[model samples]
Target: MNKTVWIVLALVAVLVIGAFSGYNSLVNMDEAINGKWSQVENQLQRRADLIPNLNATVSGYAQHEQAAIKAVADARAKLAGSQGVAAKAEANNELGGALSRLLVIAENYPNLKADQNFRQLADELAGTENRIAVARKDYNDAVQIYNSKIRTFPSNIYAGMLGFGAKEYFKAAEGAQQVPQVKF
Candidate 1:
């Protein structure tokens, strides 16, 4: 009777330890996912911040292309006010499309492309876009890890009990696959 009681206590201890470990792991992964997402948001904000300067510089040279300029401003505002990963991703994609059109329009104005200020701002925006891409990849990777953890066997049981749910992936916005028309 004593040996059986000891065995049962040991089993319970192992189960408790396993549950605690799983819970802690999930917490850590979730935190990592949040951190990665913040990096993505930071890069996106940087891009948004650069837009006004670019808009101003281009406006000075391409005064007639107000439509393209307005599109960028609208997209930037939408991105800034957007909430949640999916919404933000959609907004960011729209911003990306708008910016692409703006750049394409810039090609028509030789003076805008030749201006040093425009070049610098465009380079900065390009770098920020690259950073945003990297950050999004990191965020998605973290989400994958976190989702896998919560969906696995023993951890899945603990995760469900602890209320840990899978996170949504950052996906390209609708119409992103279509090439944007740049009509002059």
Candidate 2:
């Protein structure tokens, strides 16, 4: 066989192996990221479920805190209703802010704060928030892995050919951790 023919055959073999490995790795990584995203959604949903109970408990003592309750509800709805990762993350950050304000409102009602039901609900919500933080971290980790695989050299070539794109991180919006200046 000619030298040119041997060289071409060797190049083709390497490409075939590289393409297969890259494509498979991308698929697995994408699936892991998607799974992590689902966990994040579930954690957020759990927090949303806790809102109505928390609001009702607080409302019994602070009836006039209407606008604040509505704000929490609205933010939860937005978080649930959003369609994409960026939209959901933005909404989640807003919801966190709104709920923080509601907690601050709770501080004004000493009797309510001392109630067992209210205390339990608050504890559950706090636990949910912790879970959300952990879940978001996991989701972001998966996103980093997937995005890296989808962008790196040989994998990037395979990713483009296979229609894989960079997965988004569920990032906190501005002031996500700040105490909201509650007008209520």
Clashes of 2: 0
User: Runs in model 1 with CA error above 4 Å?
Assistant: 174-184
Best by TM-score: 1
Quick one: best lDDT, which candidate? 1
The sequence of per-residue lDDT tens digits that candidate 1 reaches over residues 119-179 is: 9999999899889989999999999989988888988887987899889999976776889
- How many clashes does each candidate structure show, in the order listed? 0, 0
Cα displacement (Å) at residue 182, model 1: 13
Show model 2 residue runs off by greater than 4 Å. Answer: 1-7, 176-184
Q: Model 1, 132: alpha-carbon shift in Å?
A: 0.6
- Tens-digit lDDT track for model 2 on 1-184? 9999999999999999988888888888888888999999999999999999998998899999999999999998998899899999899989998999999999999999999999999999999999999999999999988888778787877788789988888888786478968695
* TM-scores for the candidates: 0.94, 0.91
